[model samples]
Target: MSQGLPYDKITSAYAGTIVYPPKGTYGPRMQQDLQLVLLHTGELELTIDGSRHAVKPGQAVLLKPQHQEYFAFAETQESWHRWITLDLASLTDEEQDYLDKLPFSMPIPEALNTMTDMMLALQNDYLRQDELMRSLGYSAFQMFTARISLTKQQELHPSVVAALGYIRQHYMEDIALHDLAGAAGVSPEHLVRLFHVHHQMTPIRYLWQYRVLKATELLSQSGLSVGEIAARCGFKTAFHLSRLVKEQTGSTPSDIRKAAWGTAN
Candidate 1:
């Protein structure tokens, strides 16, 4: 028999498709909340707390709070992943402990297909935001969590998890591969291999992507100019920041700022 979820309500839900650049990557950082991601098409690779896993159609990645996870599309392919973020505080201590013990990735059981479908349906209801629809969405989300709790679980490599934490906390500064390796208490070469095996990129590349992501948030939410944002985000100059932003997002820093401001107003 399956165990029930500790929570009675889902605070929020979302469904969307993300197109990753052929060589692009996202995250090697800790999640602030619990997130369940269902990959509908293509492939998505993730390193959860140093253990690497690949999620495909009908497979889901369950990310617990404070777990260091990073994701990227399979090489040269596009991925369509559905996701829902749950509020961990809503869960009872027992439920939270159960969730914490589950594997990072698992197959979405055939019986739970309906609930997976409901996730997308819930996404629609959430967007509509009508009282009845929202209530229904919450119910569906609760059922989804209940079913998910029964799946198999995976483990993480402690050393890699620690190394990822160090990188995430200090990414805003100039970081070197050896520095990361030292922090992980591993040889520099071994750390590079760990990064490749797990993150699919070198430590420095992961650091760069992390900085760029932070810069994008600042660009959209703050009044800081590109030059200031560059320095704050660890870029050597505005030109470096602009080039990377354009490469990663296909838009210049000025254009991104304008678009963000336009949306805010």
Candidate 2:
């Protein structure tokens, strides 16, 4: 039997590379694939599993599998990175544990600089049609995960978890900080502090991001009009939806539809 090409053997569930331009948002996007994002320049804000992180220069973000990762650049800075789509079967027990503990936004370590260089080089090779580049890329992911696996464990506070849960449930509706504080059984001031300490996002920004994420899914999976989608996602109007979508995804609903279906009727 002949061996399959590496790219060919890349299962639909497998990982691949994605490049983001200046002022780009990779998503209000979620994937089942394991992804390691290395920020080349610019700042990246990642909201994963209802927490927000701002990762700046010389830092990296790991997107955990099945977690919702929504990203937007802090400015018009060009942020570029490579992603490897990986299936659950490929991860070892240790790596799985590491991923479970993460969706981290932290500065890249000096020790991992060598690995980052190698991952970038492999991206170039893969672009140039080198089949061995896939192997190199996988190795780089491994090294990056191994580095994180060694970090000390941090305990999560009860209020933080409650706030995250409330966001996930009520993202499609209008909710206020006091509402979340009530759900978490804390005062509004205390809830705000918990959000800052654990998630780095205020409650309102998290709700906005969550709504945008839901709006993106509706845009992709349903045939709803922009106005309808805006209402469904708790936006005041289609124009508001259009503006926010453009600001976050660099495209309007009509634009996304046109790209997906070739034309918007």
Candidate 3:
């Protein structure tokens, strides 16, 4: 009997798929929302930030908010995926912990088919205006988290935590990789390697992520324009800020402001 996280509610979300086997680049450069991929057939390689992971049939991948992601099929690849996404604010801390332990992409077995089916069914029912589907969606999400929790936990190295903390505190200004490496008391190269292994991105990428996250808060909560926000976030220019935001969030400064306003109202 697994104790699942409590959820206030769950609502049906948009669903879509990308069929492969004959194309050039076909995936979005970056995603703005939470995304889930259910692979039904073939293989797909997903690049989340700078880390690469392979997802196969009977497996799934969940993309967290604000992460940069891209995917491509191998040549002669036969791949089909069923993807759907719901808002991530619905996940509790306990459920999020479970999710963080699992690999970005992992296999799903037939034993969990019923739970997956329930999610699919809820997606359909909720889209069709069946109010009860919300409850079922939340239940299905809890079950998914429980399954991930049953897997072994991966310990975060002390150095990684220290480095993460350093970034969180000092991301606004320019900080060298060697400075972080020295703080962690490891060789610069080793620090880069280890950070990539655990954090799934280079230290610089993490720094950028931290800056962007801060910028987002300022953008939404403060009355800052693109130029002001860019300067505050340590970006050289508004264009640079726009480029980074587009790369990481698939949206520009104006768009983010609009989105913030939309949410507020």
Cα RMSDs, all models: 18.9, 18.9, 16.7
Q: Point out the worst 10-residue segment of candidate 2 by lDDT.
A: 1-10
Overall local distance difference test of candidate 1: 0.62
Better candidate number, 1 or 2, judged by lDDT: 1
> Given candidate 3, what's the lDDT at residue 236?
80
Give the clashing pairs for model 3.
Answer: none
* Pairs of residues clashing in candidate 1: 103-153, 103-154
Kindly list the per-residue Cα lDDT of model 1 for residues 1-265, writing each as its tens digit. 0123422334444444466655558887888766667776778778877877877777866677767888877777677766656553466676667668665666665423443454454444345233223323333343344344322112334556667778668877887888888898899898888767655567777677667767877986799988999998889999999998665444467755654454311
Candidate number achieving the greatest TM-score relative to the actual structure: 3
Off by over 4 Å in 1: 1-4, 90-94, 110-113, 122-265
| Candidate 3 lDDT | 0.60
lDDT of 2 at 257: 56
What's the TM for model 3?
Answer: 0.46
Candidate 2 Cα deviation (angstroms), residue 61: 9.6
lDDT by residue (138-228, candidate 3, tens digit) is: 4334335434533523466667667767876777667889878877888889888987776556877777866775776676568888888
Model 1, C-alpha of 162: deviation from truth (Å): 44
Assess the local accuracy of residue 158 in candidate 3 as a C-alpha lDDT between 0 and 100. Answer: 63
The reply for model 2, stretches above 4 Å from the true place, is 1-155, 262-265
